[model samples]
Target: MKKWKRSARLVDMTRQLLDQPHRLISLSAFADRYQAAKSSISEDLAIIHETFREEGTGLLETVSGAAGGVRYLPIANRENATKLSRQLCAQLENPDRILPGGYLYLSDLLGDDRLVREIGRIWATVFSGRGADVVVTVETKGIPLAYATASHLGLPVAIVRRDSRITEGSVVTINTVSGSSKRLGSLSLARRSFPEGARVLIVDDFMKAGGTVQGMIDLMGEFRAEVIGIGIMAESQVDERLVENTVSLATVTDVDVKNRKIAVELGNLFTQGGFFDGTNPD
Candidate 1:
């Protein structure tokens, strides 16, 4: 193999780190791959680290010792997060998005790859230090968001199914009420999806009265898993929410179907101190 020059090596290294966020890569491996000294690799990493921080892209953490390595953490600073939230809010405020029964259409936004990935990055940044072992979401619409977030966190995604599937083998099921519709529903999870006492981060496409999210929380209890955090792409403004302490990227403040009007704003994520301010208390 041809020895890679410093410039080429830096580009390749940056790609590797960004491609696999929250994963540790040893300097020795890079040194061997590039046919360069460990000191040279360290310098290359330092440059990448500085660029990532200055650009608000993310952070590189160094682990020292015999088993030491560099880990890339994908986090967007407060300014970038706020900018993204505002942009999404603008997109969501279209009058055409107003649906019947005071719901807003979001399938297009959730289906967009670029938008979903960015939202995933935001959620990952907010919950990075929560010691999450897996990202959990209900089947269907929330699956993409869950997988995107799990990719950034280097964790597996565990999906809760509305109905039990035979392929999933033994499963645990729970019953809960929908806060908006006030209808009883059941959610199930595979027994082997995660280990007992796992710390889970729940991600969902939308939250209306927080019923679905609250159901997921109840399902987690059946497995003896801990709910570390909950992230929603969008939430509706309601007089009362079934669940509390959730991070949302955007809020649907109003949806006047009769008048064909809609309103959107940045959610509690901005008003909430820790995540919005780019400081995580864990």
Candidate 2:
């Protein structure tokens, strides 16, 4: 690497940290890259950490000892999370999003890169300390949300398909009943996509009675994987859920198809732990 000014070094360092997410970079690596002293690198890290905290973006976690350094932990403070929840609530309340079966359209919002990324940050933040080895989701719509969360958590994603495809190679299959309609369906996962006895974090686009989520959990058991956490973008209000112990961003309360109305509110984001202090949001 060529010699760089402190300003240039800081910018590059920040980029490297963001790009790598949970991968730790030794202080010496940064120091050698910019031909700066170890002390100088430490100072730069402090400055970056302060900025990250103030913006409610993430945190720079430092490790001590000769083999230790720092890694970026993607997280959203309470203030940032509240803003995102409100935005989601407003967008979801649109009556035009209602479909024939009273289902709300989510493709547009999920396609919004900015919104999806922010939601992923929250998922990653909320599930950070759970020690999940991989992010798992059923195919189709849940793929993007799984990848988004995986990116922030620095883990690989395993996709589950509604049907086994030759393209998926050897696979394990499971049969499940739809919690909403009581319809029967099958889900399959590539045998090699996930390792046996791995810790899993399940992510999904939406949930009604959690039949799909339950199916995934049952599948995980087949692989001997322990599911550590579950994150859902939204969940429909139901009298009884097939699954529980989930963190959802929003709840779809009422969808009056006749009146073309939708009611949505923020879901259990704050009740869980690891969020920044709410007294004085950043």
Candidate 3:
């Protein structure tokens, strides 16, 4: 590759490393892939690391001991975070996103590792100073995204169950309203899973009426754990206020199934224009 192309490729590699920090890769791997000498690879990394330091981003540390490798710690400024949030919200707002029960489906986006990692990183940064002890969510579908958030925060996750299973052992069940139906339903948590006084962040796939979220709060009360934060992948605007300390990546409203038209709004996660570039990327 030409010199300019090589540098651009190096920057791309650096970004990839930042996205998956704590996972190490050898210099020889990059050198071989780029068809460059080890020294050239080292020079590229030096420039990347200097950019990171100048920007106050975390280090791209090179371990010198046995089993040494490079790892990138992504420290995105507020601008980067906001940009991502706005982009995600706009994508969710597409009129064709309608699902059953007026829900805006986002399973496809959640399954995209790159996008989900960005969302998780933004959440991790927002809650970095909150001293959260764990990330919690009710499961089946939310597990993957919740896991992403938990991975970003270096925290463990506890799952709430809509239906109790014998495999979970003894449990503490709570009665609360279901998110889909207004009627009350029972949810269960495995007893002793969380110790007393745990600070938790609640996460989920979608939040319609937030009945399931309230059920989690009730369960948290039983264990005396505090709900420090809540996040959902996508939320219907009709029920945004049902939970507090919540962040939604996208918002949808005005679903007319017969007309096959739905309205979506990019959520307020980046509304303050605090972290984003202050304009739509498109």
Candidate 4:
């Protein structure tokens, strides 16, 4: 058998593992495939894991106890992440989609099954093994994307409400400041909405001043669930406060009605890596 350099072989292995991170394969299997010593294979896995962490793609976890094996997480390589996000944002450039009050109409994009599924897949990839157990969102518009993301993660969707529906029976309600508003409004959660300690991914259609995001954050606390991450369809870049560890498909600066143009910029989520360059291996 021809011997391959450890660096080259490790890169190749990383690609295969990332393509299916949730699937586990034995160390012996990897060693046999590479025709390398078990020790060498283990070392290669370590190097790949370390590099992946450094790149913020995801984790390489070794399962212990019976039925244990090495697994790659479906985390995004920075470049792929950026490119995916940029593609979503670019769709906003259509002048026809612009609406009154500086809003960009995006129901058409969100309603597209393929685009929603792709967006969901990207979110799932980012939070793949970070232990997010449920996806949560407020009512109406955010439901489709939230359900799409939940489906990819194989998790349940928890709904927070702007107003409680009597059909849900008794509910828990909490009052807090909405994004950018000094006045407090109530956000409600249904009884048994989620099990305690379930990690949550918050999704929404748009984030303007973050009031809605904050409402969801507060709601999560009431359920004793932790927010693993937040994802948004798009963000109004003009309002910076709405974002913090939040990923958006695009950031809009100005929706120019008079000029028949919308000034959009790539959000920081894409710029940190991936979208700008193809440096990520997977």
Candidate 5:
């Protein structure tokens, strides 16, 4: 058996909690790991929890029972979240982001590892305690955001594809229509990816009219899954919105292709959600 000094043990304990968010770790387990007494372990945990709460990084939830343990919830501070949202809006307002079709380019932002991780932190914060068993997203563009959120939530990612592939082993596909152009499309999900009756949190990079988000909701129905919440990195304005109860970090109000101008603002995240101001509603 190996034992660590109190300071060394504290560092490792904090690292483990951060790395395995939402995972319950028993007091006895930590005691055994460090060859320390349960009292020592409890003190260490209290110290860590206090620091986390003060920093607004997260809080440690203590479950009481013979099988009880502590779990880390990766929640962010409202002020930090506000700063991030403002940065996203500022970055999105650049006229250079305006595309020929009046769409804004987001590849640059999505490619930034640090920015993507921070965005994932906020999504995890907003959707915390929703009883989500998995993080769901569409194929390709939404993959990164989904995985990032999953990492913070300690959940797996399930991707819905545009076309069913045989390699998926067994699949379910459904037809959907884009609310933007009224274009018809098909979405598919592997049957083995997640079990039936699972609870899911949908995460995506962008949304317009929410047709794709609607398609994903339909796909979840096939698995008898319940959608706890939806998180979008950015959502664009549309005349006919197709989905509701979505939280977004930024809102693209207008993209004038002829004038080479774009208008962006903070999304509905801070204004409306169960996690307004980064506090739990329940």
Candidate 6:
């Protein structure tokens, strides 16, 4: 590749970093790609790093040594996370979101790519240091959230199915009770989806009583996999929670169907002190 101007190089470098999050790009590789000296590549990275910090885009961690390089971690600061959470809460407060079964309508929100990406960034931030090998989520509604999170973490997504599928090959199925209805249900995961004892980060669209999340945890145990972290988009108030230590972006404090009123608030992720500190409760 021909040598490019600093301005052009900066643009290209930023684009590359943004395109591949959580990937380590050696300075030597960048130098060779742009046909520039290591010193020049380092200078370019410094500028990009400062800009990322100022804009709260995320952190660019530089590793030194022979195998050293730079890794991008997609994280949202507390202020930005709180702002996004509040906006989502306000949107969710709409009475039209109330479904017949006392469930909140979140399909529209999940369908929005931009919103899902932002939420994914938040989830990535919360579990950045978990050393998660894969992101897992149950089939259907949570698949998008799981994939979005996986994109930022640079990890593969392992989807659990509600029923066994022939295409998935050998599977492991587990029985669990539905939190909302208390009905017995089964979830299955393909045996080839992940290796044994893999560290997994679990993500879900919503949590009423954590029954589904608990089921996923149980399923992970079958493979001897570690549940490094769990993230929930929204969790509703429940008298008894089947799971604990979950990080949630928003909380549904109250849902009054007859009065058409819904109370939503920033979740424990905001109130919890260790979220921005990189200390996961899980």
- Model 5, position 122, has a per-residue lDDT of 90
TM-score, candidate number 6: 0.96
Clash number for each model: 0, 0, 6, 5, 0, 0
What's model 5's overall lDDT?
A: 0.89
RMSD of each: 1.9, 1.9, 7.1, 7.1, 1.9, 2.4
TM-score of each: 0.95, 0.96, 0.70, 0.70, 0.95, 0.96
- For 185-209, candidate 4 gives per-residue lDDT tens digits of 7788887777788899998888878
Each model's C-alpha lDDT? 0.89, 0.90, 0.73, 0.77, 0.89, 0.90
TM-score (C-alpha, index-matched) for candidate 5: 0.95
If ranked by lDDT, best first, what sequence of candidates would result?
2, 6, 1, 5, 4, 3
Q: Could you give candidate 1's per-residue lDDT for residues 68-180 as a string of tens digits?
A: 99999988788888888899999998888866676677789888988888888899998998899999999899999998899889999998999999999999998878998
Q: Distance from true position, residue 205, model 2, in Å? A: 0.7
> Once model 3 is optimally superposed onto the true structure by TM-score, how far is the C-alpha of residue 120 displaced, in angstroms?
0.9
Model 4 segments more than 4 A misplaced: 1-65, 69-80, 176-185, 239-243, 273-281
Estimate, for each residue in 173-211, the C-alpha lDDT of model 5 and write its tens digit. 999999998999999999999999999999999999999
On TM-score, the stronger of 4 and 5 is 5
Task: Kindly report which residue pairs in candidate 6 clash with one another.
Answer: none
- Ten-residue region with minimum lDDT total, candidate 5: 273-282
